[model samples]
Target: MNRLTIYTLFSLFLFTNCNENAAEKSLFSASKSPNTAQNIILLIGDGMGISQITAGMYASDSILNLERFKSIGLQKTDAANHLVTDSAAGATAFATGKKTNNGVVGMDAQLKSAKNIIEYVKEKGLAAGLVATSQIAHATPAAFFAHHPKRAKMENIAAQLLTTDVDLLIGGGQNHFEARKDNRNISKELAQKGYQVNSFMTKSLDKIEPNYKDNFLYFTAASLPLSVEQGRDYLPLATSFSIDFLKKHNSNGFFLMVESSQIDWGGHNNNSDYIIQEMLDFDKVIGRALDFAEADGNTLVIVTSDHETGGYSINYGSSRKKFKTGFTTDYHTAQMVPVFAYGPNEESFMGIYDNTDIFKKMMETFGIEK
Candidate 1:
């Protein structure tokens, strides 16, 4: 009775404990799986590489809102035809989940027009908005709403913007819309489309309270907006305002793309101070987005860059208070960029992937098929 009974009881005890542990593991995994987000806020810092973020962190006394993000990933920034990606292709990858040739916007390498995330969200009854420090018709922001083959076609891009169902548009480039060669005023056309079109020539953004009932468009400049160092202080404010306005405008949810567009320009100019200033400004915008996501609990905030510009690097002898920076070129380089994500489905973004995966991940996070 001793050996046989003891062996049988020990085997039974081991089987029961293993079954209980398996059940607990399954429950934990389900709880941590990606949950759908009500709102998705994508903040793109153009040409914001690791060096740019490091410089900004050092310049800002070693504190960055990016550090608050726990899920981070690296994205390969290559266009369909080139190793070094331009903003148009880079942004198109994020907006459309397609690898297009360099200089293409909202289209693939075969010149096929792709539906972007903004249009997809709008079709699903979610409001869409774009905020940028550059012209609204610029490559990055335009990719979200326009389908132009060439990024240089600002006039065409502006025209396409008038056709989209985007709820809010805040940036520069009023001339591309109103002062067109066709002698047509797109602002009036936007007004006809039920948008409250205002410009820097008429009213400042800080003074006017946006009405959520009507779509809003505020051109910050006639052409390209000024740099942050040139007293362009509206990025953070625009970010905060756009989030609130889009939230109020749409009952289901909203998709907003905010771009700190000038950081790439700084890299192109090989200006270290320019990069640092723009980087710091973009960090503030990220902080505002994080604050909203933290409070809303149903919002997903994804921060990343299209590609790395200027081949930027933080050199040796850099201190926590100062950054010794260097640049390899004046244009964008073939390098992978970093992606930081927070809120719902943030875990999906924590790995190495293609740039187009951003659009896929965001769409998945919103529970949108395809």
Candidate 2:
């Protein structure tokens, strides 16, 4: 053949090989292994930034509850509109794999409700839940179900709770659900939706027996209970109930979210005493989850926070009589959060990425279509 014919043949060969490679990539992607993680436990330590972890790790008692996790990951907490993220946007990033505006719930930056992991789980017939120390309508918890322009829209957030397909929701803020001053009562509406609402004071577990199953525990309080070290056993009881609920109803597989909300409150209020106690207390539940994962062997446990509060820092002990102190600006800050994961498929969390990446990681690990 002439030189021109030879050149044309070479170009055709290259194009054909490239098309074949693309087809192979798509085929392998569709055939990835399933049955990786039958169950996932996502724990969010709201406002418990990296400094909070360091403080708690050092100042905490002899044992670290989350020490068993074999893998660790770092998360970047920046909102779509701003580098510093409020609770709503940060939590929404974890829930929906999409950066939304600060003060928005489970919506994209456009203020439209986005498909959170919970919603995706529901579509796959997997059970989902939320347990927190703050109001059920709080920004962190609401991001799983509510979408609105402002995080202050508690009334609408409360209403959104009734519409979620969650198998359980337990936390404080009964007031938001009580009809008052033109606001509707969502508690009554939730009951109508087949949820059994129960109340628990700071240390009241008489309503639920240990190992009890088949019931939802709705503990409504004005604020999260003090840590167990602060003499609040009810918080542990509630945590236990949350685990039991997931194990029972979600035997087929489940996604459980537990929040230690007081970390944020203490961070915001700049109370060192409360922050340490609360962090330690939340650590205990992390212990419980670790225990469960070890036995089940088919679960992945993740521990993380939305963002740092109080600008918490560790002033390493120095011999120069120098001291380390934590400082806060009376609001949230633009800082990177820490993430630790254990059990199978936990390796997906090891890279540096935005908070929304956590959502994608979860979906990828669980084989859920985003």
Candidate 3:
């Protein structure tokens, strides 16, 4: 054979030889035929730990509906400067795949800016959305659009939100973005940008036209819908709304984030009831994403936490005394978080990983260059 034909045959042999393992077969088999993901859905159970997810499973009658996914992984959650992680630093790891110091958002440990996966999706002309159960300006959600060095800079973060061209923005924190004592309401600015900004308390979206295309919908409030157990019927409404909007806009593709923001609150306050409810509610959103993926078959769904809050530990002897009780140190811990994934190329999530590795895995699955 000619030298070129020999080289082509050698390359084909190498590719075929690499597909021996079951995991490899699942990921790259000829029948499986890996394709770039058309839809990406990430569910962040902020502050949820193993105990939190377990308790939620119990509360929901032994079903974490989302756990039905075919693949799973574990991730370490240490921050750059400490054993205990803060929200900003923990979230930055997932957002940029780099460890940043506490209080920094979408920046490195030295406070340098990083382009996050959300920005990457936008560059690819994919619809991007952020959904959280906390103020949209909170650490986790703000990381999507705000690139400031300080997570506490709410006003600046609000202004940054106006600049990003995201397809959808849903969550609480009306105070920061709207009329407040500081006489700053970014909702008006977003409205000027042709976004249908809506405060959560407003009785109606009747003012929003049916054909509100390429617009933002802001559910203004400092926090979101109450815990699931407290208002079980309404728990998944926000998640449903966000997912529906993503499907509508992402005819070509989309990336959506659903965050159950209050799990961290319960951990901070040491309130078991609230944590369980939030977790269950968050799981429901995961179920929603799975349903979408199974139907579409071209979507990728990943579920994980930014970090474990409350230093949550469950004592082995407590099952009898408390039907299992949980205690916390009331702060974030460097414990490893669990990752569950489904849809095409979901097997990539298996094995141990650093929190930043999740970003790399997503990039690999979708073939996006770092």
Candidate 4:
């Protein structure tokens, strides 16, 4: 063959091979890249241990919203100062990635404040919201936005809510804000700060449509809210409403923390029926969150508990429709809680880890450092 013809053929062969390899590399890249979610919905079922979940599933005819999750992990629940962690400290570990003392909210062992994931996300221009069945100033909810040495300081926690950038607030504790020892009308102050504040006494959640142009707040009760069995029925609806409100409030993205707060109360009371009822209610809310995430395809839904309560267990003679349960204690226990995640980057939550890793994984999902 001629020298020019030989060179041309070799160059052509090289180009064809390069093009084939590039196509293969492109396919590999698509499969390997993390499917990061645009929005995150974190659902905290306080004191919901494995037994609690099991009981709920049985009571629901062997079905639960949690069964939808494929990515599951176990989280070690221990406080900085105790083997058994309180909701405040366990939630603080998840919020700030720091293991604080029991009964402390958003503060470390030394009473120093730690910046929570919500604050970090808000600083990045993402909207944040909090919803719970308990008082808004309760330990689990308060840990995300308030810093206090003691979680019992509901009045102080109520004051801190007025200073937060949270776009939506739904729960109880109206009395803490309106009839405080300091006589500070926090609800009025919230309205003055450009929030559209409403209450169960003034307007039901269905009556008040959320407007993203202004912040929203809905007080469910004067103190603690009623249990699901006692006529409280807004949790599932509120979950759906908050997701819509937050998405509209921020075009970039949003972070929402929803709590089925009374599950712990049921555990504290050692009432199996109460736990099952609360669990079923929380499951409905989970279904609502999963519905939004599955449809959007850009939302991550994480469900977990701070710790186990009551050392609860299913006893003998339990059927698929009924649970014969027993409890070892009436307070919190040093038990590993289950974590179930779905949607983009859900795989990151798999496997056992510390409670604080929940915070780390969430930050990594958002491409945030420290």
Candidate 4 residue-wise lDDT, 1-370, digit = tens: 9999999999999888677763354344334655665688999999999999999988886578899999999999999999999999999998999999999999988899999988999888888999999999999989999999989999999899777788899999899899999988999999999888999998999888777889998999999899988989999999999998988888778889999998899999999989999999999999999998877766789999999999999999988867788999999999999999997789989999999999998887776777
Worst 10 residues of 1 by lDDT: 22-31
Which one wins by TM-score: 2 or 3?
3
Off by over 4 Å in 2: 1-35, 201-203, 209-217, 222-231, 316-324
RMSD (Cα, Å) for all candidates, in order, is: 8.8, 10.9, 7.0, 6.3
TM-score of 3: 0.85
**For residues 324-365, could you state the per-residue lDDT of candidate 1 as single tens digits?**
778899999988899999988999999899999999999999
For candidate 2, write residues 1-370 as lDDT tens digits.
9999999999999888677763354334334553357678888887898767766777764667767766787888989999999999988998998899989989999888798888888888788888888888889989987777788888777787666777878787777777445666666777777676666643355555433333364765754445545676444555666767777776667888888888888788877667777888888888888887766666778999998888866565622223266675757788877789986678778878888888888887788865
Give the TM-score of each candidate.
Answer: 0.90, 0.84, 0.85, 0.91
**Pairs clashing within candidate 1:** none
Candidate 3 segments whose C-alpha is farther than 4 A from its true place: 1-35, 180-182, 204-212, 220-225, 229-235, 316-322
RMSD in Å for model 1: 8.8
Local distance difference test, candidate 1: 0.90
Model with the higher TM-score, candidate 1 or 2:
1
Per-candidate clash tally: 0, 1, 4, 0
Every candidate's lDDT: 0.90, 0.76, 0.76, 0.90
